[model samples]
Target: MRGHLPNAARIIDGFHVVKHANEAVDKASKAEAGENPPLKRTKYLWPGNESNLTDPRPEVRRDPAKRRSKTARACGMRERLQDIHADSANRTEAEAGSKALRSWMMHSRPEPMKALAGQFRRHRQDILAYFDRPYTNAILEGLNSIIQHAKTRSRGFRNMDHSGTMIYLTCGELGLNTVTA
Candidate 1:
């Protein structure tokens, strides 16, 4: 289903992918925080006590420190996952996801996904046209990652310009050679 281009791709897959990522993130978050609905580590379920996290996998216990509230953490994770999706990003994620969107664009040109080919046959030209593009949106994603990391380390920006300047400069440093407004 994901082996097609922008046109043939179904919108549902995007939601599914993001939803799975969120589940993973949420499960890990709760497991760490010891919050509502205690989560068991499947192969190694941890008891409420520290001594319970015993097993071959090296006693792993995550402490969800007060960096943010549980709800805040969940929201942030969801946002990040959503950011990887284009339809939700206004082509923002397309910069990275659209370009580096695997599973769909990976396969082959000829005998492409039959279902997808049939669906976007009319739009094939535009879909295949992606090759002509000089760069992929992956770069934007890289820039976003840098920005996220910077914010994490610096502990949020003072304001919009402050954050924007930092992100812009970071993009430049990372070789976003051509800056578009």
Candidate 2:
């Protein structure tokens, strides 16, 4: 991509990165739940809501079981990484915070999270570039979704031109004011 667009700013969408981190946490949690019955059915509790969590009590803090659980640890690390995005005021700060998170993940017990950390390390610049550019392909994705919906409605267009026309009619901003006779 850089080779084709030499001047374009390469950025990894923060949304997808966080989503991948959540997936890693989910995988860890599922595996942990198989061994620890208490962790079962708590899948939804971590992936999305973990970031909103407040500090744990000092007593829970002292519990080795809670601290040693791979899922718990992964969720904690994922939450911490999300905090970097929420709290960092500038690119430098975001980068620093992400580096710290990456280091933490590298040493963490969860294999999935360790792999995710490696991905973050490999795409460090592209991921951190998001702090500077703050751009995502959301609009393009929305348009693609709309087009897909149009295609599904048609089932199968007879020709390429028909498909293109359908997409244009569905997605184009055509101002069709009523014409009186």
Model 1 lDDT per residue over 1-181, tens place:
5555644422234434444444544544454445533333322332122333455422233434332334234334344435554344344434454344333323422122222324334443343344333234555567778988766665565787766666666656745455556
Q: How does residue 102 of candidate 2 score in lDDT?
A: 87
Best candidate according to lDDT: 2
Off by over 4 Å in 1: 1-114, 119-122, 131-135, 172-181
Query: All models: lDDT?
Result: 0.43, 0.80
Return the TM-score for each candidate structure: 0.26, 0.82
Q: Highest TM-score: which candidate?
A: 2
- Report the lDDT tens digits of candidate 2 across residue range 72-119: 789888878878877887899998898889888989879999999999
List the RMSD of every prediction in angstroms: 16.5, 4.1
| Clashing pairs in model 1, backbone N/Cα/C closer than 3 A | 2-104, 3-104, 95-137, 96-137, 96-138
Count of steric clashes across candidates, in order: 5, 0
Q: Which stretches of candidate 2 lie over 4 Å from their true place?
A: 1-4, 50-68, 173-181
Model 2 steric clash pairs: none
- Superposition-based RMSD of candidate 1 using all C-alpha atoms, in angstroms: 16.5
